[model samples]
Target: MLDIIYKYQNLLANIDEYIEDSKFKKEYLIEQLGVSRATFYNKVKKKSFTIDEMVVLSTILFPEEAKAFEIKEALRQSREDSKAGKTRDHKDVMAEVRDKLRA
Candidate 1:
């Protein structure tokens, strides 16, 4: 278990290095990320990625694209909230979401 976790950590670190060194290519990097081929294809077939995946990929493969996606803006907001120790009440957020959906 420890070995597997260590390997994964090393893999993630190498990915970071590749991103910084501009050596990451889509196919290669995606493979190197160590997700299963099925997962990769499913994500591709779905034509969408989770926010965390988007953040990592865009922040690496193309920061300009990330900026355009407003990831930086969202991160900035998160940072500000952290600094101020502010947090959204989940119930409030959920109620707003429900209200917006109803509208």
Candidate 2:
């Protein structure tokens, strides 16, 4: 439960940063998210949102940010798996590094 909360908080924080960086107005975001201005404000104030809402907002409002979030989540999962002794093979590590470099 705590992990879920933390993940939501991180996503919300990232969304806020993206909004600021993109110079998006709150009214625009509300419209994009298909919510009333007051509803959007209330959700932001309470930091409570459904996972579906998050995904939808991320997908439609800021696709680049959504991709960034996906990458971040992949990296986090890889780290956690490594910590649990699920480390990848050396060749896999090299391949991943090469892919990153190529990117």
lDDT on C-alpha atoms for all candidate structures: 0.66, 0.78
Candidate 1 segments whose C-alpha is farther than 4 A from its true place? 1-24, 31-33, 64-103
Instruction: Tell me model 1's lDDT, rounded to 2 decimals.
Output: 0.66
Name the 10 consecutive residues with the lowest summed lDDT in model 1: 11-20
Lowest summed lDDT across 10 adjacent residues in model 2 is found at 15-24
**Candidate 2, 87: how far from true, in Å?**
34
Please write out the lDDT profile of model 2 over residues 1-103, one tens digit for every residue: 9998997788787765655576567777787778888888778767666787788766766678778989999999999998999976999999999999999
Q: Compose the digit string of candidate 1's lDDT tens values, residues 7-101.
A: 64554445444454675655664765467767765665654455566456657676576577687789899999989989889999999999999
Give lDDT: candidate 2, residue 68. 91
- Cα deviation at 93, candidate 2, in Å, is 37
Measured with C-alpha atoms, the lDDT of residue 16 in candidate 2 is 57
Mind sharing the TM-score for model 2? 0.46
In model 2, the number of clashes is 0
- Model 2 / residue 52 / CA error / Å: 1.7
